[model samples]
Target: MNGGVVTDERLQPDYEADDSSINNFEKSVSLKDLEGGAGQLPEQVHTHHGANGEATVYGDFEKDKEQDVEDLPTTTRVVTAQDWSSPDDPENPQNWSMLLRAYHTVPPALFGFTVTFGSSVYTPATHQITERFHVSSTAALLGLSLYVVGLAFGPVLAAPLSEIHGRNIVYKASLPIMMLFTLGAGFSQNFGSLLICRFFAGFFGSAVLAVGAGTNADLFPPRLRAIATSLFLLAPFAGPSLGPFVGGFAAQYKGWRWTQWCILFISIPVYLTCLPMRETYKKIILKRRAKRLGIAPPNGPAGLAAIKILAPYHFTISQVGLTFLAIGLGVAISTASAIITDRTLYQKRHRQALAEGRQHAAPEHRLYAAMMGSFGLPIGLFWFAWTADNGVHWAVPVIAAIPFAWGNLSLFISTALYLVDVYGSLNGASAVAANGILRYSFGAAFPLFTIQMYEKLGTGWATSLLGFISVLMLPIPWVLFRWGPQIRAESHYPTMIS
Candidate 1:
């Protein structure tokens, strides 16, 4: 007797049946069942097949289904919010640790201090330079003016280049060029040679002033950027004030050429200090990181996604350009005011009095007073230029300038802070470009007709012309304050308020 696998009412053979007739009969029965007729197989047998054999056979199908679920793609998701509520997300540059931000900021500040110190140190050394080159005081002033011109224009090219190359590259390249020119400036034999070299040196040295601002934004977030910006701006402002003090002494003791050499000596240590400073611009840093990770660099949508995540508040180039223009215009107006009031008018009248040996010569303090009296550079220029021949005590113009330096510093500081606050990480490069363009163009153009104006119209009228220009520039700050929000809203760059 054959023993087959048993169900409740029928048996299924697990092995081949000994008789072929039984197998053929089973096939016929299955075909009849497919035609919708009931087979001879019992219900208990069907239940047994369904519970044991069919269930066991379908078990492998479930296992394959689970494997498919495991193979589905997964991704990291970002939640974009309109404000700065989170502190730990990588999106906020402010979220970076204090030590890291400091690392990015210190070098640029020192660089600015060094460069500006070098630039203006020549002011007190003008006499030494004149004696060395056998040129007049006006000609020596021209050399100083030429350097400022370089400072003005260098940033236009440097700022754009930094966008293409990393900041470190521009800094390293520009610094060395500045050094070479500063060093060469010492060896120049004639006035023209010195002027050309000084001009280029000013141009290259401007990198510190312009690029440093942008670098600070890269390191700090908007909430904390004001302090960083203040620190950066402090260098340039303080440098000019202090440079003449130090350069005066150095030029007095060591000679004018040594002023250039001393700066170069100081720069060596600063340059070496920059060795450990890492590049902070997110795009360049991440791109290099991707190469190291053996992943393909992000492209198209992926790249944009990463950039947007990293920099949620970035500004477009055009906005930055406009901001720079406004800043430049303001700076030019201020400078022209200074020239109109102080150099063209005050100095001219005061010197004339001394030359003629007037009965009651103006006290030297009048010069100081004129410098200190104005609301800013322009007011000081206005007071000094307008009052030069007024027959009042010379002390009046000098008293006026005291307010001028004060006001100028205040306005300049405020404007710088506003720009940094408005632009965030892009501040450094954008500021550099703006400063370079505005400072140079204005410095060059303002002084050109100034001498002629004073000579033709005399000090009082010449300064009044400048005072009127200052009044025009006065509306700039008010306009910015009122419409700044709308302007910032449209910017593609990151701003402090955003």
Candidate 2:
């Protein structure tokens, strides 16, 4: 007996059974004996014995002995190297090496820079597009406005869908759609057709803008997320700034039609380069792997599928209301600033005259003076509204727009960084969803009222109304800065501090 147990009648050798040996043993074991053994012991006993006659059992079966341990199927979990770590899995995406993450990050940043530039590249082309399409200037401007409108709404679907399917699918799918629609916009024969195509282009292009932020959250840790987000923010704003520069020269030399074609040409190689990048959202990737292994469904009330929809809503209804409120006020202030600038300049001469006479102006005069002269939006809105149509140059109203755009971008940068800082790795799809809702809703509604506002009240008084709204909404950011900790404490979403 090589390594066997000596029983009353025979010695059962502890042979190292390969597949063939196990099969032979199964054939030799009688059904009646197997059934009888099952009641008394395991159907099969796997024993290992040392040369010194020490015996050990590898595992035990209970309740049914007829079934040999060798007959039972062993489940070999195909664990990835990353899954070997703890469930909190700092070694996961959150703890990925800096170099590995930068590889994922840089491409999206490039993609983002390109996409954002595309968004407003048409701004300088508005004059040319107007002439080409035989439409009013305002109608041609709608092409740009509609693109933003698409951006506003694209995230509702793209963000939710990306959560379900993974960021890669959304990114890859939307990029091509964006490229196609952008190309189509160049060929449109009429204003309606051009506006429709441009809108969808913006909508699909928004997938990159909305999803890139989430992708960054998927890669970087909490402390590093802010810097990543800031860099990301720089792309969109910087793109907008640079876009006009390119568009100005393009419109000056190449036709406006060439502008759309130029962007399309630039994006083609970028789309091809992104094809190899793997999905970064952990849940989607793991769930996909688990499916391939034929595992039973995971145990949890909030299953993976539900997370796609629930997570963003959880973040939005909870953390982002203040952010949206702040942004909305900022937008209102911006629109009003155009009107305020005109009004303030008209009052400038009156105020100077009053100063020379040494006459006391009312408390409201100082308040009005403070608002008119300051770089602040509330003042600009108050001034622009009243004086916009009072023989002021169109440049004055447009220049007043500078502060609103600057302030809106600044507030957006701060709020976005704050959200990323507080949310960390969990910020991916949820943050995208929240931001999509916040930005698009405002983007859509803001432009619709802007012209109507200036037309009704004259730029001066129209802006003053907007300034009042901003004043009323000013408490939102203050509250967030003060009570954000308490709000974070109460949130169910994974927060950085936790």
- Mark the regions of model 1 whose C-alpha exceeds 4 Å error after superposition: 1-96, 287-498
* Candidate 2 C-alpha lDDT tens digits along 92-189: 57666777777777667677667766765676677688787776443455566456655754664565556667889987898899989998989988
RMSD of each: 23.5, 19.4
lDDT comparing candidate 1 with the true structure: 0.54
TM-score of each model, in listed order = 0.47, 0.49
Q: Whose TM-score is greatest here?
A: 2
lDDT against the true structure, each candidate? 0.54, 0.55
Deviation (Å) of 274 in candidate 1: 1.3
Local lDDT at 305 for model 2: 18
